[model samples]
Target: MNPTPPPTIVIVPGLRDHVADHWQTRLAQRLTAAGRAVHTVPPLTGERLALDAQVANLAATLTPLSGPVLLVAHSAGVITTVHWAARHSADVRGAILATPPDFETPLPDGYPTPAELAHHGWTPVPREPLAFPSIVAASADDPLGAPERVAAMARAWGSHLVDLGAVGHLNPASGHGDWPLAEELIATLESGPALAPIGATPTGEPG
Candidate 1:
């Protein structure tokens, strides 16, 4: 029998760690059931939590995983992953960024503006090609960012973009308790090209 593939799925949850029943949490469970090792980083909280600490934590998480590593990041977690990857390219094989909030855009009322985000040390994404392939998935109605902004980020990072229709923020609050589509997307990322658009039907085959 063929040996099982290396377990290298690193799941980075958003502002807070995914709660029970959240799609990201469910996806991590599913991957684990399939014999893949999954790591969920602790949530970054408090204004005092340094962004560099978060980046370092991510790097530490990636260190022991065998390659080619596949990174799965959601929301603000996407920013963390990208920032870490830009500096630690050798640690990652590819990435799937979901519903990334654009720091370049103006914030909504009661939200921090881009400058404020930067003031808090959330840096703008680097403008160089990533060491590995990456796919960015966004929704039509994400309150934190526009589709165009997400697409532009993908282009800048040399990644692929997928537009999920009207799926507000693609988070648990949006009623996406268990996103089977995201599982399919992960399977696709494991097999084929690094970047595939959203809504592209997978050809019949395991990744």
Candidate 2:
């Protein structure tokens, strides 16, 4: 039999949106170079912080893909994916949510305040189980999200939590670039195994 086609990979950036050196952007370029179907959500010049616009943009990006799609979202993009998943579950095969920030709480200097996040419809992040299976990679030392909080989110979303100890937010500022493990997690999701049930213990990084 012919080999099954690979799923289209969607790169979802955080609020910063498409940083030149960000792992997500590099991953997209690398994957596209390797001949994979990939799509990225473009940055919105206006209403950049509005969660509704972000979700809609994600939806629009996915609307044209015809096969199984895997989402790789980081930071705020993770929140956007959950919000989109709450309403539309079709076509998505799986997702990898990395180091999602705790928007409900006060962030450190230079980030949006809790009130601003709420005003932009980013607060009260969706806690219900997602439409498709997913894996959440969380950092023990992520400033934006406490490890305990990230674990709770993973549990609530019924995702298998991959505990990445002390990886500060898994961003460029956090000293991570060309994150090789992202491809591994995406492969696991594409293999189609059921993720850990809601409330399971956080696990070491997935192989």
Candidate 3:
């Protein structure tokens, strides 16, 4: 019999698991239904755990996959994943970071302020290029991060940027209960190292 396929999708939810009807949950379900094994690591509270602990958790989750893994992270989850990638890029195949809050910029309304999180030792994006291919998706109106800053982080990490027009944080509040675009991007990552340009609209074209 054929060996079980290595898990292709690893869903890293932020703070807590995606709420009911959240887009991330939908994306996970859809990918699993499409014959992809989805691994959802339990959420890490950035407040209670040290950054190193968070990174360790992420690394632990990655250790079991036998093949290239497509990492899907959102919100604060993006920061944790990027930090992990900076030090452990060889373990990850590629990543899709959606609505990564600007860790260097002051926080805006309805989000954690930089001052509030400064005590946690939040660091700026490292200057080194990520060891593998990656993508950063941000909204034109993401309250957590400005578009220009997100683009800069993408550049720093050597990742392609996707400017999702006016999609606030790309969360449940943003009305994205079914994020088909994200599913397609993760699928693309599983197939190869190259990714489409930032502004190229993804048509959910299945691989």
Candidate 4:
């Protein structure tokens, strides 16, 4: 009998352009070394329409994969994944959302301002629970989000919350280059429950 193949791992970075030392990039390298199929979504740091296009692009990328998919998204990428999953979650098995920022609040300097964020359709982020199993990892000291807000979002999304404990943003500035623990988190999704579209009722419920 043949061994079961690993699911395709999709690495998703925030709206900013890619950086060499970003932990997500480094994680992709490690996954590649382990012989797992990995694909990183290209940078899409433009306005709201660009974000929508990027989500569509993600769908195109996953369409051809032969196995289940596990999405790993960081920062603004978490919002992207959420928006994407709202439309195309049937292909996803599970996801790990790390250090998601509170889009309804102010963001860090150099990122889009509140007006720009709204202009780009970032305001009123989706609060609906995801269609598949997911985990939302948050840092106690993340500047882009408050612990309370993250927890609230997690509850709204029906995702398990993971306290990372004062790891500021979990980015390169936070000294998270080459995060070994991320692999452990990803491993948890390997045996996660099967995918079920959001709002899909179980048997005996009216449609």
For lDDT, the strongest prediction is: 2
TM of each candidate vs. truth: 0.85, 0.93, 0.84, 0.87
**Cα displacement (Å) at residue 147, model 3:** 0.4
Superposition error at 114 for model 3 (Å): 1.9
TM-score, cand. 4: 0.87
Off by over 4 Å in 4: 45-49, 193-207
Per-residue alpha-carbon lDDT of model 4 for 1-207, expressed as tens digits?
Answer: 999888899988886677888888888998999899999887654543465777876777777777788999999889888888777755677898988999888877876777877776666788998887887888888999998899888888988777777788888777777767678778878876553432332221000
Question: Which window of 10 residues has the lowest lDDT sum in candidate 3?
Answer: 198-207
Per-residue lDDT tens digits of candidate 2, residues 1-207?
Answer: 998789999988888755887889888998999999999989888888999999999999999889899999999999999999887766888999999999988999999999999999998999998878888898888999998888888889988888778889887887888788888888899888776664564545422
The pairs that clash in candidate 3 are none
lDDT of 2: 0.87
Error of 2 at 58 (Å): 0.3
Query: What's the CA error at residue 92 for candidate 1, in Å?
Result: 2.5
lDDT of each residue in 1-207, candidate 1, tens digit only: 987575378888776754997777888899899878788876656542356878887887777666567788888888888788767755465677888987777867876777877776786666666777777777888899887778778788877777677888777678777777666667767775645543342322111
| Candidate 3 RMSD to the real structure | 3.4
Off by over 4 Å in 1: 1-4, 45-49, 194-207
Residue pairs with backbone atoms closer than 3 Å in model 4 (clashes): none
